[model samples]
Target: MPGFVALTGPPAVGKTTLAAKLAAVHGAQVFRLREFAHDVRHRIDVDPALFATEDPLGWLPDRTVRVLLDSALGGRGRNGVTVLENLPGTIIQLRTISEIGRRLGLPVVVIELTASDAIVIGRSLVRRVCPACEPDLDADPHRPARAAAADSSTCATCGNPLRRRRCDGTARYELKLRRFRSRIPGIRREAATLDLPYQAVNATASPDDCLRRVVAALRSTQILPCLPADLPSALNGATP
Candidate 1:
């Protein structure tokens, strides 16, 4: 049977980080939407005559996800949990994505990361660079360097400041809410069908505490057959 776990929430809630930690513990494959977009962004260049647009989701992430889903289910040795990251935009779109998982017989679970608005706004103001091209800065993509020059808040290699990019206006926020609604139902549906619990995580807590909470949640739900020995260290505070 196919299986899926989505790490979702308003942007900058530490979904990406949590996803990584979960994947590490479960030995799962992580499919990050941003990474997928970044990898293929250059390949789909549009000409000026075609009335181009730079909407990251329009071409890259959406396409990449569809293709990835097809390939992952079609491929062999895909027994482990598959973590889908940064998936929340529109309600209809999210439902469509969840349906895809269901059609593939994937046991789906949704984990919504929650943090205070202050934390979200603060993190969103930080400028994070693309990790694949700027790994020297930091392995965590959300914490990119602020500058290329050596500074108090910058990476030594690239000097880029680590921060989250804030989206202007209520548009993005509204979109996020819609996505949440869409997945909330999917989570309930999955729980009813598979007899597995859905989870919500508070990422603002102490690293150890947060990991403990996640591990506890997973254990209480009986999602994991056995807790991994290294899970504690893996989820403890990531790179600064």
Candidate 2:
């Protein structure tokens, strides 16, 4: 099916983790908001300071996002769902992506993954992104990302040392979470105005359970072509 499944939520909600899993199941193209911004800004000479941890999205204009999305959709073949991580965040972004979705004959479904502050803060302590796997101001959106644990020393995929994201620090993460909360209502309203389906998923459960909820929600919307056979009936059951 030709459609998009956009993921949105505060810090440590596991947007990337869920997106990766969903992309694997659907064989979908994946777009991370920061990486996409980095790619476009690099091409057009956007000021490096605009990407500062405190206000990464503050200076990113909707026009930039719209043009990039249009160009991206124009270049790619529509075959399966495109899993977007932490995208369509602002009202303008919501409106712009919906326009692209309409003009390009693709459906847009927004999925907001939610987790409590306690859970998110706890996750922040453990979440680590591999630098060698993905460079900051990332130019390559398709590069593989290696997820690492809090105490891990090296990247599992690339064998390079893993590092914590600067923005993942306590104060910065809390700031980003506040920004996410402030902007989401407007984004949700925009989705409603555009007649797009928006779903909120609680992500405090185990990763498999959380993924199941997301997959079930997407399946209910019928954006996917069919049920994914890879999903087991139960993670653990009696051995026969």
Candidate 3:
């Protein structure tokens, strides 16, 4: 049997950050919403909203789902945990995903990370870009500064401009909050109904400290067999 872990939270609340860290520590493979959307986008000519409106079930086909389930269960010989970020699209579909995991005999854990609204706003403001096409500027050595300076450059990864045009920081923050509000209700509701244990993490603190707490939380619930004895210290301050 395999194991599945899902991370969900409000905007800029560190779901993805924790997912990355969790994947690193546990040697898990990540399957994020954006990456999943990207895969679907490459196959179909449709906007995000269009795709969402058309196939609310998920971006992938039924066949793809089966393949993914098999792979996640180690049927294909690729073995590791599956760390899903922004999964379980809506409240109604939560059980379906959980059921799949259960049928596959995978132990599933869900963690919700949160922070102050202000922290989310700040994170959205300076989010960086595709490193390849956005060349560095001598004046501003940092990535975000250089990206902002050469904002018009096309992304080497996607060939899209390094832009926040339609969904800049303010817009993204607003949309994120709106989406968060819409999603949290269902997340909480479904969590209450599920057999899987749910954990809430205050990621407003430093990532390292947050990770320590997260590991401890998982350990407390007996989700993991054991946590490493020598946990690393959190870098920077309590908040970033």
Candidate 4:
């Protein structure tokens, strides 16, 4: 069995981007919890009221766990690491993940990305998602090239128009951020109790810099074999 890496972070903190990069480096499959939530919502015709709650996972059916587990363990080939994004949001979900990890005989490493609330809010305002590539792009005023691309309403990767998710407004984003903040302590405690290798990476820097920090943290924990040779060149000298 291969190792398991799970990423958790507040909204707009670049969890998806980091997960994508890690998956690329390890030749792993990325499993996103939001995608699974969407499938469950569509299948069960979830109540709109559920969206208003701080805990959206509470509305999901029991079978949702099975789906998540299958995605994490089923299709991934032998010796293939799996990178999980925005998963195990609740204590119940975390416990379930612990069980699945044990059953699969894969050690789980959880990395949480942390950023100031102000930075998170600013990122939420200008962040755009590329549907085809499934990665979020920073389009803040400071990033001129990315901002220009976003202004032109084009995805740099797929040449499609960028998109804003429904939860992209100030009020909704703040509420979601609060919910994420409330869960952090509990998640950390659970991870410690489970004896999982957990670390918090600062996400206030550029994405490349943050990725370097994450890679370094993983290397320190011995979760990653080593930094990929091409990574330094790709990241403009980001060392492991």
Work out the TM-score per prediction.
0.61, 0.80, 0.66, 0.75
Q: 3 or 4, which is superior by TM-score?
A: 4
Q: Model 2 segments beyond 4 Å from truth?
A: 42-59, 137-151, 158-160, 226-228, 231-240
What lDDT would each prediction earn against the true structure? 0.53, 0.72, 0.57, 0.68
Give stretches of model 4 more than 4 Å off.
37-63, 70-72, 75-77, 130-152, 157-163, 226-240
Backbone clashes per model, in order?
Answer: 15, 0, 1, 0
Better of 2 and 3 by TM-score: 2
In model 1, what is the error at residue 232, expressed in angstroms?
Answer: 7.4
What are the root-mean-square deviations of the candidates from the true structure over C-alphas?
Answer: 6.9, 5.0, 8.2, 5.9
Residue 22 CA error for candidate 1 (Å)?
Answer: 2.3
Q: What are the per-residue Cα lDDT tens digits for candidate 4 across 73-160?
A: 6554246667777766777677777778787776778889999999988888777666555532322111111323545577665587
The parts of candidate 1 lying over 4 Å away from their true place are 37-68, 72-77, 93-97, 126-151, 156-196, 231-240
Model 1 scores what on Cα lDDT?
0.53
Against the correct fold, how does model 4 do in TM-score?
0.75
lDDT of 1 by residue, 130-211 (tens): 3334543322234333354546555555544444334323465445445555566665565445554468778787546665
